[model samples]
Structures are given as structure tokens and as C-alpha cells.
Target chain A: MSMINYASREINCKLVYYGPGLGGKTTNLEHIYGKVSPNTRGKMISLATETERTLFFDFLPVDLGTIRGFKTRFHLYTVPGQVYYNASRKLILKGVDGIVFVADSQIERMEANVESMQNLYDNMSEYGYDLTRIPFAIQYNKRDLPNAAPVKDLQASLNPGWPVEDAGQQKVVPDPAHPGENLVDRVSNEWIGHAPYLEAVAVRGDGVFDTLKLVSKMVLKTLS
Target chain B: MAGAASWSFSENDFKQIQQHLLAFLRDSNARCALLVDRTGQLVATVGDAPQFDSAAFASLTAADFSANDQLAKMIGEHEFASLVHQGQKESMFLADVAKRVILVVLFDQRTTLGLVKLKGKGAVESLTKIFEEMFNRVGAGPGGQAGPGGTPQKGLLEGAEDEIDKLFG
Candidate 1:
């Protein structure tokens, strides 16, 4: 569900960063908090244990430049990646307008990544918003590390709808099969189940802004 | 109950009213007061918690209240009037306005519940006037066509009716 504030002429959308434990969801937010201009970003709130596992989502509201004469604000949140925290994850996804799934690229974390994605879908399904229908993107973090999955293989397995095409490749689809398929197809069907997937090292800030830009475009498009 | 006595609000009028409200809340020593649409988007917020994510709080609270509304309907209870969540350090109180916008107040346990309720009611009274104008602007703008199920006014009435049904069913 979208929230339109007539008074402020601003649309505030929730974008949750989701992934498996230690997948860099929180680290991704910390990098953005450091890089984004102070004026456009809000306080970054994190509830984590002493060892730094996220207890709840870390929230940061980023204000993108206006669109169609209205201020565009994106509320960025990161869900607790630990598997047992499904309850908190569902709480965070409430009223989310978009999602950024951060998958750790280490070969050892593949099962955890898949399980987390499946959890994301199940939680979203309970709310009647297909994970694929909402504006969303993916970031395969730890790309710079040893044993990172190749983007080609990652996209093949994660984003079946939008396969990795040359940069700026254009693809279109009509009559998307699943409601979630629409969001996936907007970028590519090859990435459908795997839509909005990107490669990056979140700790180092690779591909972060690109992911933000893509999500912003989808949000504005959804509003209009 | 005559049409001659009814009040009307315009766009320009609402802007001024909303600004005044921000100022009023600021003066009242309230940490933050949010005018949220039924969907929980913060139409306006007052006081400085620049570090606080008002937008996310509003969205989550709205989702919580909406889910509670459904729950109320399922068990033959009245529509959810308000929900107050109190923790050791923080407390959140949510109130509905015209069944369209929700007023969310965030405060420390130091603030008295009575004080928040009083100020919240005042905020709602002031906001109702602005909403009346907003309704007018939506009607007069562009094609001036009504929303689904006819005019926005009709939709507003129907929305209220639905709320009532859930409350009394």
C-alpha cells in the first residue's frame, strides 16, 4: 500500500534491506549513512547485540531530489538476517514500498541466502504483496572477496527473469505471469525470480547508489 | 444541520493551517506530533528529531493499526479506536481523525497520558478544518471526477460507513 501525504506533497516509501546473517544488509546501510549528504539523510538507528547481529531493522530515511514537484523520500530499513527473527522481519516489512535483497556472495553462504529469500517471499505473501510485485532490487555483496559467485551464475540462479545483459540493455514483457513477476519483468524476466539483482561489495560501497537509483525510479513509476 | 452553516477549506487555507499546527505542536513542548493519513504516511510532523525516522514510524504504525482493524472485524469487536504501546523508555499513542488520518504521538514515559490525550484532541480539531479544505481541492482539481464508487465525498462517507460496520458488527 502506498502512502500519499497531500500536505507535504511528499511520498514516503519504505525500502527494506533483507538478506541472510552477515550478508551485509546493515553494513550496506552504514556505508550509505556515511556517503550520502548529511542534509538528505536522517539518523541511522540500529538495534544490534554486542557481537553486532541485527536485533531489529536499522532505519535511515533518505530524501532523493523531488519528482514531479514533490519531495521524494525513501525510508531505508534493514531486517534482522538471522533465520529465527522472521517475526521481526515481518514487522519491518509492514508498509514497505520496495526492497533491496543483499545476498552474500561467498560460496559457503548460498543455502542461507536462498533460505532467507524464501523467508522474504513467505513473509511478504502473508501481507498480500508478492515480493516480485513491489519495487525491489538485489545486491550480491562481497563481490570483491575470494570465492564470490560469478555475477553470471548468480543471475542465472537468482534472477532468472532478467539475465545479465550488456549494460543499458532494454527488454520488455507483456502479461507478466505472477504479480511479483511485474516488478521482476520491469527490468528483465531473466531476473524475474531473480529480478533486480546487482553485484557489489556493500562494505566498500560498490553499486550501492546504482541500486538506490533503480529502486527510486520504480517507486516514482509506481506512484504515477 | 443546514448547508448554509457548513464550513469549507481550500488548498491555500490548508497549507497555512498545517504550518500553524507544526508551530503549535512545537510550542506545546511536544517532542513530535505527526498528522498521518489512514495509510500512515506522515502528512506533517513537528519538533526536532531529525535523527528520528518519522516516516518509517508512521508507515509501520499505520500498518499495525490497519492490521488491528481487520482483527477487530474478524472477532465481532468494534473498529480499533486507538492503540498505546508502552515500553520501559518509549511510548507511542495512536489516535484516528475522521477515520481518515491517524495522529501518532511519540514521547518518553515522563509525559503523562492525560496530557498527550488533551493535546492530541486539540491537534485533531485543528486538523479537521484543514482536511475539509483538502477534500475541496481534490474535488475541484483537474477533471473534478469522483474517486471510485463516485465522488470523493461519497467515498469518504462510505469509508466512514465501513468503519462503523466493523466497529458495531
Candidate 2:
């Protein structure tokens, strides 16, 4: 249930950053907030503990141009990653329109990522929301870090349903001469169907826009 | 104590009461306590109920109470003093505090109704001072600004205009 504010003519959408603890969800948002035009963004408020852990949530409202004469404002929030804060997380999800599940790309965080995704699915079930119908994107972040899982391994383990092209299928293409360099072809070469997956070093701003563009498109599509 | 009686009705006095409420609820065996404005916006909360959706709950509860108030009016009563909702497992007690705010208590069935009402009396008396002070602050002509939306960051009431339509005729 998204709210459309008629005064500002801005359709306000709530997009939550959800993932396991220490998955860089906050870091990803901080990067985006810093990079976007200051006039289009508001103060980023973090209610973190004295130890630098998010105690409640972080709220950052961003304006993403206009859509059909309505200023599109997205209120970005991040849930406290600690498992004990599940109750507070549930409260934050009350009117969420989209989600960015920041999955740590390191090999060790695989289990944590799966567990957190399951928790999200369960919480949405409580509110009678079908997870597949909601606008959501996955970011395999920290890709620049050492010990990061290979993209192929991550696809197989975390996103088994991911649509990526197999090497055998690539041979049938016979395009080794010039190589399929189009964006759509590249995405299809990496996935099974047409789902777009972004790899990012979020702190350095790499692939950040790609993720943002995908999420913004998905959200607007859902609204219509 | 020169202005003690007038002070009793001021928001400054209400601050003292709000501080006391925190200490009072902790000792009362109640898990959480909230002071909700007549509009159902939470003025304060105590204990570890941050997980509770205070904003949404307050808005919905205010709607419920507003409907109840209308029902009371149909029965020829001017207003409702309090509402106590008890289910099999959990119970909520809402009481009016100085006609401006509602004091809400959430607890398990283990708590006694008599004890809760007695403590609520003391809490409400203290909270009345806070509400009076808030009224003065608000009535002092918007602290030099215009109405709510006049401030750059405050559109809290902008949302309320729509909310009012949902609550009352």
C-alpha cells in the first residue's frame, strides 16, 4: 500500500535495505546518498548504538526525478541486521514497496544470506504479501574484496533459479568472431532468462547506478 | 512554589511527569507504557516495545476509539473516559489523561486490572502536567512559525488531514 502525497505531487515509495548483520546494506545506502545530487536527497539519519551498530533504523529520503508529472520520492530505510531486532524489522516493513537484499559476496556469508532471505519471506507471509510479486533486487556486493565467491558459484548456490547461459549454450551461438557485446546479450549470457543481476563494490560506487536503475524501473512498473 | 498551581498546568511541569512515568512503569510489572496524543501520535513510550508498530498502532487505535466515542455519543454520552480490551492472552488498557492524551498499557494476563487502574491514576495525573505544557508551547503561536506545514521538515499534520477524514464524519 504505497502513499501518494498530492501536495508535493510526489509519489512516496518506501524501499527497505534488508539483509543479515554486517552485510553492507547501510554502506550501500551511504554510498548512494553521497553520490546522488544533494538537492534531491535529504539528511541520512542513523539511529545507531554507541558501538556503531544500527539500533533502530536509518531513514534517507531521495527524489528520483518525476514520473508522469509526479515527483517520485523514495524513503529508504534499513532494518537493524541483528536477528534479535526482528520485531522492529517487521514494523519497518509495514508499507514497503521495494527491497534491496544486499548479499555479501564473500564465500563465508553464503549461509547467512540464505537465512536472512528466508526470514524476509516468512515476515512477508505474515502480512499476506507474495514475495515474488513485490519489486526486489539482489546485490552481490563487496565484489572487489579478496576471497569473494566467483559469480558462477554464487549463481548456482544463492540464486539457483537465476537465468544464466551455460557454456554449452554459448558454443551454439557461433558469435566468437565479434562477441555478443550488447547489454541485453551480456545479461542473457550470464543468466537463464532475462533477470538482471548486478555485481558491485558498493563502497567505491561501482555498479551502484546499475542496481539503482534496475530497482527504480521495477518499482515504477509495479506502480502502474 | 510561587506559581505552583499555574505550573501544574504547564508543559514544563509535564516534563517532570514524563520523567517520573518512566520510573513508575518499570516498577509496576508492566512491560510497556505509551502516552498517545488525542490524535493517537505517541508522545512517549517506555520499556522495550520498540518492536511494536507504535505509529501505525496509534493511528488505528485512535480510529477505533473515535468510532467508540461516536457510539458513546449515540448513547447520549459526551465522550469515553477509557477503553479496556482483553483477549485470551494479551490485554490493553487505554485511559484518558487530561482530555488531550491517552495512556496505554500492554501486558500479559498475569497483571491485575485493579492494580493497573490504580497505577494508571498516578501516571495520568503526572502526564496531565506534560500535556498542559505542550498545549502552552503549541498555543504560544507556533513558536514563531505558521501552521505545521509551514516548517520545512514538519508535515506531520499534512498526513493528519487525510487521517481525520478516515476517523470522523
Candidate 3:
């Protein structure tokens, strides 16, 4: 949910980073917190276990400068990626303005990625949130790993387009990041739309900002 | 879009909210009070709040309140209306306001929990009424509308792309 504080002349939006355990969700947050100018960021808080796995969530509030005189602040959050933490994940998703699903790109974590993705859908459904309608993106993290699965394979498993039922929205929508690729197109006589995605090696900070920038733009577009 | 509940507070809305909060602080004799959205955005603050990161504090307070709500369901309760965290020197009380925001009051040895609770109940009632009126006036529902007038300002997103580029540039 976005909070428009007219008195303070600021707009605040919440963006959540979600994925399976150890899929670099927290790492994405840590990278952003470390990179953004301190003056534009707040204290980063990580509710993690003793071993450093996210226990509940990690939060970072970043001031993304001003747009039309309203200071835009985005609160970045990462849900605990472990399976048992589904409850915590659901709680963190309340009133989310945008979402980044950071999928582990390695071959071995495929099942975890699929399960977590399904969990995301189910949880969003419970809140009556249409995953496709929101400002959503996917980050194929750990791309630098030797055993990283092919992008096509990951796309097939995770980024398959959902049916675009509305005729008004069924037109071809190109993915600006990947020329010659359509984010929304007719498939097997059915219009389908996929969330825009980018590959990332989060630990090395590669593609982190690109992913954030993509989703942030989508969110701003919604607000505009 | 579902779950897109944006809340807009005009100058008049804040003035009224702050008045109530100030009165609550005076009556409760609490150190400070923070009106935070359930989504973790600090709506308003009154009194002598301790030096802390207000943004982080709002986020954590929302998380804490949310986690407690889940805990309530486990025991078959619909929800826990309010929560109190008592520290040795300083304690805080959090109450739900119209199910839209959290009313948090911070106090210390000078005030007793009994007094804070008594005053907090009245504060919550007043805050809840204010939020209800505001939500109704703005026509805000699950599908959020823009500010009080239901129109977004021009150029809100026109130069946003350039601003984002500068963030990393």
C-alpha cells in the first residue's frame, strides 16, 4: 500500500523481495543497503536466526529522491525464505505495492524455487491480490554458479505466462530489456503475459539495481 | 489491482489526528505516541519520542503487530485488539485503530500501565472514528483511490524515470 502524506509532501511504498530459502533474497537487500548513499537510506534491520538465515523478515527504507516535489520512499522487505516460514511470509506481504521473486538459478534448487513460487501465488490469492496485476518481477539469482540452469529452463519452470483474459490487455507487449521477446503474446490461441525478469548474481551485486529499478519503475508507472 | 489500498492524509486530516494524539498524550501522560499504518508507515507522532529511526521503528512495530495477529489465530481467537510490551524503564502500548492503523504509546516509570490502558482505550476510539471518516470520505477500499479529491497530481511520474536513474548514476 502507498501512503501519501500531503502534509509532509512524501509518498511511501512497500516493495517485498521473496523466494525460496537461500535464494539471495536477503543478499539482494544487503547489497542495496550497502550501496545506496547513507543519506538516502535508513537503518537496515534483519530478523534472522543465529546462523544468519532470515527468521522473519529484513527491512530497508530507501529514499528514491523526489518526483514532482513529493519525496518518494520505498520500503524494501525480504520474507524468510525457508518453507516453514510461510506464515511469516504471508504476514510480510500485506499491502505490498510491488514484488521481486528472487529465484535460485542453480539446478539443485529447482524444486525449492517451484514450491516457493506456488506459495507466493497461494498467499497472494488469500489476500485477494492478483500476482499478474501488480508491479511484479522475477530475479534469477546465483547466475554465476557453474551449475546454474539454462535461463530457458528456469523460464519454462517459473516464468510461464498466465492467461491474459482481458481482451483490452491481450495485445502484444514487448519486453524492453530483451528485444525480440514479448512479455505478453498470444500462445496456443490464448493471450498470456509473463512478468518481466532479469538474471542476477546477487552476492556480487550484479543486476540487483537493475531488478530494483525495473520494479520501481513499474510501481511509479502505476502511481502516475 | 487487488490489495492496492493507498491512504492519503491531507493537511486537515493530520491536524485533526495530531490534536487527538496530543490530547491522548496529555491524558495518558505517556512519553510519546505514534500513529502507524498496519503496513508499517508512520502516519503521525506526538510528544517526546526517544531518538530512534522512525522509519525502522514503524516497520518493526507493524511486523510485531502482524506476527501477534497470526499468533492469535493459532489459539482460535479472531484477533488480539492490543498489545503491551513492558520494559523495565520504558514500556510501550500498541492498539488497533479501525483495523487500519496502530496506535502506539511509549511511557516509562512516571506512568502506570493501568492509567495508560484507560487513556489508550479512549484514544483508540477517537482515532478509529477519525480514520473511519477519512476512509469513507476518500472512498478508499481494497482498490485504493487517490487523495481526498480522488485525483493524482500532474507530473507525479513524468520525471520519475530520470530521478531513478540518478539514484544509481
Candidate 4:
């Protein structure tokens, strides 16, 4: 849900960053926190274990300037990626306006990635939120790792298109970020659309803003 | 796409809410009062709150309240209606208002917990009524659309992309 605070002249939206354990969800937040002007962000809170693993969630409220006099604020949250923390993850996603699934690109974490992705779908469904109908994006993180799986493999496993049930939206759609790649295309007998995705090395800040920018725009587009 | 519901508060609504909070503060003698959405958005604040990150406070308060609700369910309770956290110098009290928002009061040596709770009950009642009326006027429910005064300005988000680009430019 997005809140339009007419009293304060601000619009607040919640965006949750989700992924498998150690997949760099927190790192994505840290990079943004470090890069954005301090005046534009609030305190970044991390509820983590003693060893620094996220125990509950990490939250950062960012002001993305003003849109027609209303300050646009995005509250970025990263859920604990460890499996046992599903409860915490669900709580954090209670009123998500958008989502960025940070998938670990390392070949070995493929199963973990798939599990987490399925878990996301399940939890969102339980909340009565249709994941396919929300502003969702995917970030294949840890691309710098030597054992990173090929992009195609990760796409096949994670970003495989969802059925495009709307006839008006069934046409082929090109991915503006990735020339020659189609974000929505016909598969077999049905038209399908994939979540827009990008590669990132969060720790190094690569593609961090691009990923944020992409999802933020998608969210704003919804409002428009 | 799951069209996100927008919660809009007209200026008059804010005035009414703030008036209730002010009266609550005077009655409770608490240092500060914060009205927060259950989903972690800070709706309004009143009284003399200490220097702290209010946005973060709202987020944590919502999380804390939520976590406690889960705890309540595990113990066979529907939900904990309110929570009190007593510190060495100050204590905070949180209560649910119509299950839509939280009423948080921060206090210290100036007041007693008994008084805060007594006054807080009244405040919650008034706030709940206010929210119920607001929700009805806005046509808000599970996945409901924004109504009339609750709708955003036309084209308010039209040039948002250019603004976002300027941030990282």
C-alpha cells in the first residue's frame, strides 16, 4: 500500500528486498544508503544476529525528491534471507508496494534461489497479493563470483515468464535495458511476461541504483 | 497488477486527529504521542518527543506491535491490544486504534503508567472512531480504491521518472 499524506505533502511507499540467505539483500540497501545524499535518507536500521546475519529486517527510508509538490518517500526493507526466518519475512511484507528479489547468481545457490522464489509466491498468495500483478523486479546478485551461473540458466530457473492472461498485454515487449531481449513473449500457446531483471555486484555498487531506479519507476508508473 | 490502495488524509482529517492527540497528551501528561499506521507509516505526532528518528521509530513500533501480536496468537490470545515498555528513565505505551493505527505515548518521571493507560483508553476510543469514519469516507477496505478527497492529484506522478533520473545523474 502507498500512503498519500496530504497533511505532510508526502507520498510513502514500501519496497521490500527479498532473496536467499547471503544473497546480498542487505548489501543492496547498504550501497544505496552509502551513495544517496544523507539529507535524503533516514536512519538505516538492521535487526541482525550477533554474527551480522539479518535476524528480522533492515529498513531505510529514502526521499526521492518531490513529484508535483508531494515528497515521494520509499521505505526500503530487506527481509532475513535464512529459511527459518520466514515469519519475519512475511511480517516485513505485510504492505509491500513493490518488491526486488535479489537472487544469488552463484551456481550452487540455485536451489536456494528457487526455494526462496517459491516461498515468496506462497507468502504473497497467503496475503491475498498476486505477485504477478505487482511491481516486481529481479536482481541477480553476486555476478562477480567465479562460480556465478550463466545469465540464461538463472533466467530459465528464476525469471521464466508468467502467463499473460490479459489480451491487451499479450504482445511481445522488448527489454529496454537489455537490447535484443524480450521481456514479454509468446511461449508455446500462451503469451508470457517475465519480471524485468538486471545483474548486480551489490558490494561493489554495480547496478545498485539501476535496480532501485527500475523498480521505483515501475511503482511510480502504477501511481501515474 | 495489484493496484495498491492509497491512504489519503485531507487537511481537515489531520487537524481532527491532532486535536485528539493534543488532548490525550494533556490528560496523560506523556512527553509525546505518535499516531502510526499498522503498516509502519507515521501518520501524526504530537507533544514534546525527544530527539530521535521518528520515521524509524514508527517502523520499529509497527514491527514490535506486529511481533507481539504473533506472540499473542501462539499463547492462544487473539492479540495484545496494548504494550508498555518501561525503561530506567522513560517508558513507552502503545495501543491499537480500530486495528488500523497505533497510538504510542512516550513518558518519563512526569507521569504514571496508570494515568497514561486510563487516558489512553479514552484516546484510543476517540481515535478509533475518527479512523472508522475516515475509512468509510475513503471507501477503504481490503484492496479498495481511493475515493473522492482521498485520491491523489491528477498527474501528480507524471514527471516522476525525470525527477528520479536527476537523483542519480
Tell me how each candidate scores on DockQ against the true complex.
Answer: 0.10, 0.02, 0.56, 0.51
lDDT of 3 by residue, A1-224 (tens): 88888889898999999999999999999999999999999999999999999998999999987777889899999999999888889999999999999999999999999999999999999999999999999999999999999999999999998999888998999998899899999888999999999999999999999999888878876766
Q: Which residue runs does candidate 1 get wrong by more than 4 Å? A: A162-194, B1-32, B36-40, B46-92, B96-102, B106-112, B115-169
Cα deviation of B119, candidate 3, in Å:
1.0
Q: Model 1 over residues B52-157: C-alpha lDDT tens digits?
A: 5666666566667776776787789878777788778767778777666777777775576667777777777777766665565553422344555443323323
Arranged by lDDT with the best first, the candidates are 3, 4, 1, 2
Q: Which residue ranges in model 3 land beyond 4 Å of their true spot?
A: B139-169
Which should have the higher TM-score, number 1 or number 3? 3
- Cα lDDT of candidate 2 equals 0.63
**Candidate 2 on A60-173: residue-level lDDT in tens?**
767777654566667677888888878666656655677777888898988888888889878877767655556777788899989899976775665554333445433323
Estimate, for each residue in B10-111, the C-alpha lDDT of model 2 and write its tens digit.
Answer: 233335655767766765666678765543334567765656555546544544565567677889999888888987877788888876567888777667
**For residue B44, what is the lDDT in candidate 3?**
93
- Tens digits of per-residue lDDT for model 3, B1-169: 5656676777888999999999988988899999899999999989996599999999999999999998999999999999999999999999999998999899999889999999999999988998998778554422244433353432345445666556445
Candidate 3 DockQ vs. native: 0.56
lDDT of 4 by residue, B19-119 (tens): 99999999888999998998899999898865999999999999999999999999999999999999999999999998878999999999999999999
In order, the first chain's TM-score in every candidate is 0.84, 0.82, 0.99, 0.98
Candidate 4: list runs displaced more than 4 Å: B1-4, B139-150, B153-169
Q: Could you give the interface RMSD of candidate 4 in angstroms?
A: 3.4
TM of each candidate vs. truth: 0.66, 0.52, 0.94, 0.94
Q: Write the per-residue lDDT of candidate 4 for residues A1-224, one digit (tens) a residue.
A: 88888789898999999999999999999999999999999999999999999999999999987777889899999999999999888988888889999999999999999999999998898888888888999999999999999999999999988899999998999999899988899878889899999999999999999999889877877776
The global C-alpha lDDT for each of the candidates, from Candidate 1 onward, is 0.66, 0.63, 0.89, 0.88
